[model samples]
Target: MSTVFDIEQKQDSAERLLAVADKEPRYILFADEFNKVARKTVESAIHNIELDFSWSKFKNQKQYNVNGIKQVHLLRMQMKESWILDAADEVWLLIDRYKPKRTIGTSGKLKSSGFKHAIYPDPDNPKRPSEILITGKDMILDFGQAFYFKYFSDDAHTAIGYGNKNLYQNRSWVYLRFRLKVRKGDKTYYSNSKGVIEMLVKNDYPIGKTLDYKLV
Candidate 1:
């Protein structure tokens, strides 16, 4: 007998939840089996997702009140499965869809000895790696209160210089451009933060339909 939780794989959709009724003994299954399938689904979605940036329009406002503490509901985003909340590793925001015209490869290596913070490994810990890797995709720069892409640099321990040092700081928003995943109780919902503009993810090539959003 298959419960409401027993899911069946299909050719085109992942939302087809199977709930079969039969008289049989119930036995626990291996946890790894579910994890493998979930990871594969997420990985495929990430690689095949069509980021539609055409709908996004950048507007300039001088006296803007940036509130970093408001939660907005996503009109079209949905979380069909509950297991994904615990299985997903990191939620990354794809800042750059395409590579920059000019790049000096990956960013400089950050030595643990150079920094005094606990985030960096200490010399006393033999098991810890000596340097923390900061790739080009991992870096983002803030300009005039707004976050901007930091191009890769060949310089040691530095990103390619942009504008003046005073105007550029390494800072990022908690959530930017939709792709919000929130959890409340057993169910998880996807939405963008308030005061943030929407950037919908359209499953055009690999999957069908679009995960669009709107402010609540």
Candidate 2:
């Protein structure tokens, strides 16, 4: 229900654009030019933004907030190692009940340590799958199935796994097409220091926001 005049007022007061477009369209013209750019993010002041907060009451479901956008995202099982590294905290750890997994970025062969069993390096060199570290139910800290990982160098960012079946019978690998994250208080985080991630959910965070805004 926004008009040309309303768009002009919004641009004048609250819209802090990241870059000036080549074509400086007018209020209505700019609004109409939404699909012209490859990828564009429009900004609005928080005070001027309207949102509805709600959630389902199922045991498996969690609570989350809705921002200017409509679609809500959930915690995906298959994710990249970089995401865990950025979202985890100092004390947090990635939890996998049956077989714990860790992700590292490495150019050469990756090494594992500090566990009871012998380390199992990946078989396929080209398509490296989720490699399990040498650990057991005994290695499970007070935090339970949350397994903590330490990196040798920095480039060892490769590995992530989640699934519970017969260990030596049949193993399945699923392709990851989504991003998972966490929410603490009013913040939604995509990555962390210790790479600890849970099936938690978050919304409208700067990392997930459409347009990155700043004080004008």
Task: Output the number of the lDDT-best candidate.
Answer: 1
* Candidate 2, 56-152: lDDT as tens digits: 2222332222322222232222222232223222112222222343345565544442222112233432222223221221121222111111121
The parts of candidate 2 lying over 4 Å away from their true place are 1-92, 96-140, 145-185, 192-216
**Alpha-carbon runs more than 4 Å astray in model 1:** 1-29, 54-144, 147-216
Each candidate: RMSD? 17.3, 20.8
Pairs in clash, predicted candidate 1: none
lDDT of 1 by residue, 157-180 (tens): 111123232122322111133233
List the lowest-lDDT window of 10 residues for candidate 1.
65-74
Task: Give the clash count for each candidate.
Answer: 0, 15
TM-score quality measure for candidate 2: 0.17
- In TM-score terms, candidate 1 sits at 0.23
